[model samples]
Target chain A: MSQTFSLAIDAMGGDNAPDIVLDGLELAAERHPKARFLLIGDEARIGAMLARRPRAAKLCMLRHAPGVISAEMKPTAALRQGRNSSMRLAIDAVASGEASGVVSAGNTGALMALAKIVVKTLPEIDRPALAAITPSARGDVVMLDLGANVQCDARNLVEFAVMGDTFARAVLGLTAPSFGLLNVGSEELKGDERVRQAAEVLRESHIGPNFHGFIEGHDIAAGTVDVVVTDGFTGNVALKTGEGALKLMRDLLRQVFTSSVPARMGYLLARPALDRLREWMDPRRYNGAILLGLNGVVVKSHGGTDATGFAHAVDVAMDMVTHRFNDRIREGLSMLSTPARVPVPATAPR
Target chain B: MSQTFSLAIDAMGGDNAPDIVLDGLELAAERHPKARFLLIGDEARIGAMLARRPRAAKLCMLRHAPGVISAEMKPTAALRQGRNSSMRLAIDAVASGEASGVVSAGNTGALMALAKIVVKTLPEIDRPALAAITPSARGDVVMLDLGANVQCDARNLVEFAVMGDTFARAVLGLTAPSFGLLNVGSEELKGDERVRQAAEVLRESHIGPNFHGFIEGHDIAAGTVDVVVTDGFTGNVALKTGEGALKLMRDLLRQVFTSSVPARMGYLLARPALDRLREWMDPRRYNGAILLGLNGVVVKSHGGTDATGFAHAVDVAMDMVTHRFNDRIREGLSMLSTPARVPVPATAPR
Candidate 1:
């Protein structure tokens, strides 16, 4: 805690750009006084914003980048032409060890592609996955592969489980977090072959004691486990579905509260309780989507998030860097690779 | 409309068993006065329950079923051992022409397996899909392949689209419904090869005009399309995720409303408006899951649902039977199989 660490910030990313980025940095700086930031963007614009925020200015070292990745740009296009882009420069900072981690709110696909090529994945992982903290009935749950790989084999899924376990330990502060493989049903023969194979391997591996077996979609919100792992396609769909459902309920609640005069008065009386509920369910509290299995930490903030949400993303990056998330993943993978010890026979000599 | 049709009911299915089944039958009978029911279960129990409901007794024909399929029994095990089970006999009634359709609140897997073998599939259909009506922001949305086939190829997806289209027309009363293939993103290249291939085929088929291309998980609740189509694995997960999210919101709302005296009074004043919201969001309104692509209509009710929910399942069955769902599917498939008409050049001979 005594040593200062630096995080690379993509100042030109997100909907609000350098303004919110700088404001978020000021807030993050206040929280982590020992943390320094390498702000990567157009130097002139970033320098102007830093002048207004004394706290962020005191801790920031600005770096110039001329280009920005648009949300609609294809990953391939971004990779080909976004060499001097703020996102690329920020990731480069992590790869070159100029910073311990990088945080961006730009296009997700572009970030994943650029980060994989520049910062590289851990040697033990076949493919890196997108992991995010989602609100559940019991508390927050970690789910992986929100949309990194369109299709995955059994090996990729097993790797996701390992990353998810380390992620829960590092970020959620759970020592022995239970995890489940997402599937159609909890039965042994329910999902596709890939999922079944993954379950089998997890059951026999070192982390088998914490594996809760196959879980269905509802289990995500039910907080059936601390971590949920699946192929990118299914995981992405489930995450979005949950978001959409929550949005629908919120909209309906608003409609109900404004339906009549009685309802309006009731809303006034219930405002405090409802406010507590709203705060508990706020999307800003769970803004960061960490791309796990990378050699260095990478957190992707929601593109539309404001200063507070962006600051939460920085907090996630700081936690990962300080907790040595990648080191834990390395240890977990080694444990997985080691075969289970067989019990010695009583008749045989020890 | 002039002819009376009989529906076979599995009296021993569901958590409540013969009691709710008969009560639901009485309600269904009141709605469809001309309809008759072949109540298949333990004759004595069904007869005893029917005695309490005069309307259901007047319209029901009691048939003895010696066995019942447990919810936890596997599909294959049920197939081999459930010959005289209420669920199997109800399906047999449809196959034997004793009833126009079959409705069960039994084990979904058993119902699907038995219905597929007994009722058989439409000649043009390669695989039958589990289609259900889900509540969406715009209204009711039809989603297919809820969990019939865990692994589906492009062909299966294309067929599901055809079935979904007919299902929307027959059950939801939509003349032309917009349908989309569910994926990770809305882009053409966002999903796996199977989805892209299916999209290509759908784009060129007869339903091309109504095809909405690729949609993400959020689109299901957004009602971006009238029908949401996907492989069983993803579709099932998405469905349950949506359900889970809604449940979470409802639970939170209740906790907020009862958190204190002021909140409790607020609940009383808002009771009417909240009741309307509850009705609109009620899972019972959308209880039936239809097994589409089969020769005869088959509806599965939620096992834990009460009498009112069971009645909704019977209503769905009646709608499919009256609308001739399979016949429409046949027409749609024939159109798909027949190549699109080619436009001749004006300069060339026609």
Candidate 2:
């Protein structure tokens, strides 16, 4: 077993809580034998859940935590309270070097706040953003600020582009991702003043120099662009739309498949092929929402994440650590600071 | 024949120009014998293209114009010079009462500028918006400002709700449509300052009394909200994203179907059912990009539209006229005008 990496899992994090969290840990461990885990929550709840799965034994260890972070409390308040909460302990496990990363399906805002206050950002990064990978026509497309740092300055947007690029390269394996600024129109000046200003700065990013100018909302999964960048507000709206669209399509496809005898027979023949196709788009297989650009690694999942979703999130942490995402981010930023390709003149520094 | 509903066609408007435009005019004329068209463009090009088309004795008429609107020029500047251009002549026909509406596939900005300067907004309408119907999971979703106004205030957003609701009712043939404001999150206060304020205004709209409140991007096709409203910037992005997603899915499905022998066999067996599915998802069938709230009727089609695409756009114009979409918009807005939804507060009579 490789003891070089570990993931702190908040056993009490999701709507399914310890049960799903523990199941995910077991699944990830089986796939990644070298992995190690720390399960933090009510010891009894986690213990009982893991007892139900004897095979999970060699992969995980448990640590007791007294409090839990609720989804409703403000992010900062939750983080402040999470000092003793299991979710925070998972984060602390990494900060304290007991683990390499943390995974949770807890309050998204709390994870973000705790990661920022506890883990800290790289030297130059102003704020961290939430990035989600959508299985696009071309493959996976990284879109960010799904809902973090709502009000951003032009510089904050520049940081988002840089962070998103790193996540794409590190997570999605795109060497030099094609980045796009999500705008209302493809025209050069077609959005709010902030978006317009951000476009200029992003266009000037030398770190991710392959920026593909502006992209529209409809372009998110078009496979036309590798990375779609936007402020947290816009990103969140776009992300929600994607989720809704997928669900809607799935429901419609289900109806069509079961419509009649001929349709049912056709669906039966198409079943295996559809299975393979779905495996490619399956959210569980691709689960992971990295809070990019944070000093420490934090991976989030749906609050109702099942055993598989939780495992994917934990594996996401393992990938971040394995790739040394933060280290590379720092190196790339430093390189840009020295002499970015699209040089931002000293006088024009954002 | 309905003599009051003649339309002028800009023969040189689309990328295919006179050829496709004339083809669409012929198809549309066959469907609506009352619909007459004045084909405005170079007489030589029109004559050349018409020579190939079956000569209809009772076909639409043609008018010659020497100038053409180049796709490259600035929108306002193009409008100013295109007065003698084919597109301008088409708009002029509507303005001069020679035609009831104009159809063009030229630059949208130029079209809007021409419509605004020539035909002008309705009695109480402040700005005209471009509303395009995009293919949704269910059918088609009407999204406004696909590229109309960029910077809009709360009042403008409220206007969009009224306009969109009216379009939904008259254009989409829905009764008392459910309205939704597009925001980053579905929460009431979770968007840009403009969206937050717009939400408040829209929620109170007499026309939006049945408003479904804030909707995220995914709701565009979820069939949850009948009409999703946002500024032109976001709306345009959402509209384009929908377009791109449809294209991406089609391409992906094609690739999957042809990847393996089993998949191909499955596709063959299901060809009939799949064909119906394809027809339902085809972007061209649902074609029509209506410039809503304009002083006069103008619809933009795919710049690369074929006869079918152009025919659909023309069909949209006819339907709007037949349903009196513009008149309905005015009525909807009147019922939703500021401070008129309720009796004045006694304490705030001033």
Candidate 3:
């Protein structure tokens, strides 16, 4: 089966649905060349929106989805009853093997609930994670459990660490990626018992000390590690804090830049550099929140994400398909079962 | 009622203790003309080191304490066996009402454990929070539960918010302190059952909505709210992560600044601007963790804090002294008794 024309997008989801979704899909189609999208939304509305735009030749035909999942709807009801809801329908397409992967900008709760119940996890995979790209000091940091599972067990964290490592390797193209635990301190035994136990499991596992042990929020921007692992609760806080902080700084910078004529002049002179800095720090750079440890890849974009962000998500999906990330995760798990494994050299970043 | 002329330093704690501890205290004393110290350690070694330095006045006099508290020492054991230890003597000076406040560069567990037993918390206060200053996008952001309690409860959170608010208003001088529960989302229903309950208590409490409401980790740095509150466990994690991310950024910026010839040239020209930015982002600017809800003001500085960091801590102490912060906290709590009477401003950074 040709896996080229993949990605089933939850077109009816997000704040600016169908319009932004279609725009993202169209741009992604142009960028990927090989990729096509199955837009899940009301056929008439989607078609109307499409007609207004100079449609890309690669735009996949619209797939009518009967209902739109309200962002505020309860996840339980949304998952159980949202059969025709665009988000659910998108997931259904993936579940039924009509699409290679799925992307949603709907309520995270509903998406997680539906994906876990329908798309399901691979054998021995107890839970899935909401992994987002965090701004680290060095580069982008992949933070897991942005808000999926609140209560985490040691085994779950280990799985998260492993899954995050795989995602980093596949998407970021960093082989033998460095992993760090989100903790209060860098030293061993500095965090809660659960974190401490997870650290031990990570250390003893084949992952080795590329497992850089404990990391704090300050380290998030340091880029000391490729992947930072934690429970959904903590990771959600960290991710939001990072995003909020970046936005806040930019806002403050703008305020200061516009405070006085001299400052404004300085800002103008430094516009290119500042723009580069802002662009680098912008949340749009890392738009996709990929849910890992499942049979198929699932990427969640922000509800307010625009076409640019959507295009990035699609690119991430393409990378997922090209790298066969899920297979690598399965293979990594299998390698754990077999002892005395040969050392794998780290995958350097592209 | 008389405070001591000198203090006993905890020569060991954190990753860069003893050495950094000595350097920091020495620097603090030199900078502050009124400051004096009583170094607690091996008399011979401390004396020898002191002799090597040019001394004017009895600035830092050594006080011998044979045993040391290891950073890994269990809290209970540290308290039990530390009767004659350096930490206790320092606290003893305070319990005996000799020193105004004690400073330690030793294990946090031991310090807090000793502090609770000796200094004790204020009446009506359920627990004391390890409150500290965080550099937000705009300015200083106050957070609590930096490293005290672990298992979180709604009541505990209520106390944290109340005390954290007072701390912010008194310490940071914000018009009306923002109070927020560091949870998964800004919405009232976000996070675990405990967090949901806490959010309600916070929302309906005398603290008004302008007092700010539920804040996520992202809100901490986003500068939307002035104060971010959580249990020690979560707060501790956020604090560390923030610190780690900042350090990572600093290190990475250094790398980027010296990456190539053009970069090096830019660094030279932009040195002044970059220096200004670094100062604005300096962790030291917002240093010192306040053990709030306690009877007396107590600040926990980085055991490895340099002179600059220590000065920040001293400033925090001075601010507390000047603002009568403890009294304000008590007043804030007492106001809670007349439920329908007063309004406590909720200033949560969103």
Candidate 4:
């Protein structure tokens, strides 16, 4: 087995804590046989859980952490009191170069605050954005600024576009991923001044060929572009709105299929087809939320997720590490800094 | 027949113009026998189409409009060059006291600009907002600022809340509608400075009893509040995202239900249940996009919508006129102008 990568996990984060975390590691270990884990949490609890999962125990090394950050803890308070907490230590592992990345299912605000402070950001990146994979009409689409920066300026938006483009290439395995800036309307004159300015900057950048201009919310699901770029406020709202709509549809479908005996019989006959639909829409398949533009890869799994969902989150981090995601982002930024086909003035040094 | 209401129709606005417009009027005429229409369009084509629809012809008076605004025309260009166009004439009919309201399926930007300029806003309203009815898990919810005012200040948000509250009561037949401000997170300190300031103003107002506090985007589809208020940028994005998600699910379900022979047979047995689902999700049921805060009611039908969708738009206008929607809005604004209880200071005037 190859032993080139290691991931630090907050074993005490999330609802199920050590048990679900250990079981999730077992599932991830089965898929990534070479991966090693640095599990940070209560040593006694983790040891007992690991005893039941031999496959995970073989690949994981346990580290004791005396404190735990509660799910309800605020970011400021958590950072002040959570220095020795499992979540913070796991992040510290990545900062200290002991682990390639960090994964947690803890309080989102606390995790973001600690990760931003501990893992740090790339030299060129002002803020790290939270990106996730969403199921679209054509396939998966990458959307960012899920809740990282509340109010982004034009510069922030341009930065997000560059980060999102690199992320789509790394995670989705696309060679030349196309991107679109999210706006109310697709017209050049639509939306606010900030959005129009960002569009103009993107239009003149090195990535102009792959930039698909402004796209509306519907285009996100239409798979009109590989990447969707937006400010945190809009992106977060769009994400939750889509999730709520899906839930409502699922509930309505359940009611329809169970309203009558004939419908029940039809459901039985179509069980295999229904299963395929469920698998396709399963939340576990699209579980990971990557905090991009950071120095080390950091992923946040859903707090209520089971082993399968947690495994998917680990897989996302592994994909980033294996592909050297940060290096690609740096290269993309360099290209952005130097414009293509622009002649330098004679007075300036070339 | 009663002659209390007359609506100005932009017959040359939509894709399948004159014919669809006449047909939709026919359907609407049947439902509201007392209502009359002032049709503004190319007189030759409208008269030809109206000959077949005796019901609509009985209530319609055709007027000639030599100019027509193309769908590709920008709002500014359309306004400057389209003074004699069908859309402008329709608005002029309302301004001239010949019609109670105006309904059009034209270029949205052109329609908005013309309506705001000719129809004008109410004295208390700084800006006219676009509001729409959205289907939710619980029932119908009213969402405002769909795309009119992009960047809203705290005062603008408060005004939208009051307007949305009155709109929900007038059109949706709600007695005491509840309100929620859309934010990235549900926490009090979750959003940007403007959202927080808006929340504070709402909290201190007489409408505080009906205010549902800050809500995330998911609450829109979950029907957590009767009225959802936000800046135009975020609301537009959320609205389209929800629509896109619904479309994606519909497409995916089609593929799943027709994948195999057994699944095909199952679909036949489940046809009745599926039909019910289709009726529930029909776009025609929620077709109208109302321009609120205007002196007169203005509804924009989807440009690509058919006769049935256009009829729905007319129905929304009739409901507002019959209910005296603008009167109700004035009453609500008066209540906002006078607070429930005043905490007078030593130097304040009584």
**Alpha-carbon deviation at B280 in model 4, angstroms:** 0.9
Cα error, candidate 2, residue A132 (Å):
1.8
Q: List the residue pairs that clash in candidate 4.
A: none
Please report how far candidate 4 places residue B98 from its true position, in Å: 1.9
lDDT of 3 by residue, A73-178 (tens): 8888896679889898888877777777898888888888888878889785768888877776567778897888877766678788888888888888787889
lDDT of 4 by residue, A253-347 (tens): 88878878888877877779889888888888999899988888999999999999998999999898888898988888777745422332222
The lDDT values for all models are: 0.88, 0.75, 0.72, 0.86
In candidate 1, position A76 carries an lDDT of 97
The residue pairs in collision within model 2 are: A217-B237, A217-B241, A218-B240, A218-B241, A219-B241, A241-B218
Superposed by TM-score, candidate 3 places the C-alpha of residue B277 at a distance from the truth, in angstroms, of 4.2
Candidate 4: where is the Cα deviation over 4 Å?
Answer: A1-5, A337-350, B1-5, B337-350
Between prediction 2 and prediction 4, which has the larger TM-score? 4
**B113-229 per-residue lDDT for model 4 (tens digits):** 988998899997878889999989989999998989877777777888989998899889998899999998888878877778778778777677899999998899899999999
**Ten-residue region with minimum lDDT total, candidate 1 chain A:** A341-350
Write model 2 residue lDDT over A176-291, tens digit each, in one string.
88988888767785666666667776665575468788878777877678888887766776776666666565666676677667667766776777777677767786677888
| Candidate 4, position B316, lDDT | 92
DockQ for all models: 0.49, 0.36, 0.32, 0.49
Model 2 lDDT, residue B301, Cα: 76
- Poorly placed runs, candidate 1 (over 4 Å): A1-5, A337-350, B1-5, B337-350
Interface alpha-carbon RMSD, every candidate: 10.5, 6.1, 8.5, 8.1
TM-score of 1: 0.95
